[model samples]
Target: MFLMMGLMYFVVDLAAILLLSACWQRTRIRGFAIVAASYGAGIVARWTAPLAYRWADSGDGGMGSLAGVVVQTAFFLVAVVAVVGFWDIYRVLKQRPAA
Candidate 1:
């Protein structure tokens, strides 16, 4: 069961990486920097999510639980995607030639 879960996580992560890379080129961002920056920010957010849960839980039963970690990771991923995706679309439009 653990193996399957790990596999699923790997597959999903791979898909996300591909999606981000493919989408990066079309942006006026001009370099891989934005992708790297966004990914780094996401990682930091995920790492910090436990603190969020702890605060919400009033200092008890923090993200010490498996479910909490998963929730935090998912939230971080979504937030990163939203912020980065929006910037990417904006960049794409800016880079497009006048028509």
Candidate 2:
């Protein structure tokens, strides 16, 4: 079951990336890496979201509220964006015209 879930996540993530790429202009490899990382993080968070909710009320760690899930998701998105944006900028710089 766990393996199936992992495979599904990978497939869904890859499909999403491919769909996005169809409308966007970027290197396939870079897009794949960014999307894969982001999707993996999302999958992990979603898989653990329920646990987060359950533990949030445990009143022990810093994640002592349902808000933890939201925070985690936001953090994951930010990380993905940062990585993708940095790579895009690098690509742009690398393609700059010679002075």
Per-residue CA lDDT of model 2 for 1-99, tens digit only, reads: 977986787688668656555534554445445555565566666667666677676766666644675867676675777478458756866787757
User: How many angstroms is residue 22 displaced in model 1 relative to the true structure, after the best TM-score fit?
Assistant: 4.0
lDDT of each: 0.60, 0.64
Best by lDDT: 2
Per-prediction TM-score to the true structure, in the order listed: 0.40, 0.45
lDDT of 1 by residue, 1-99 (tens): 956875675566556666666666654353334554555455556556656666657745553565576676776676666676567767777778989
Q: Which run of 10 residues does model 1 get worst, by summed lDDT?
A: 27-36
Q: Worst 10-residue stretch by lDDT in candidate 2?
A: 23-32
Pairs that collide in candidate 1 are none
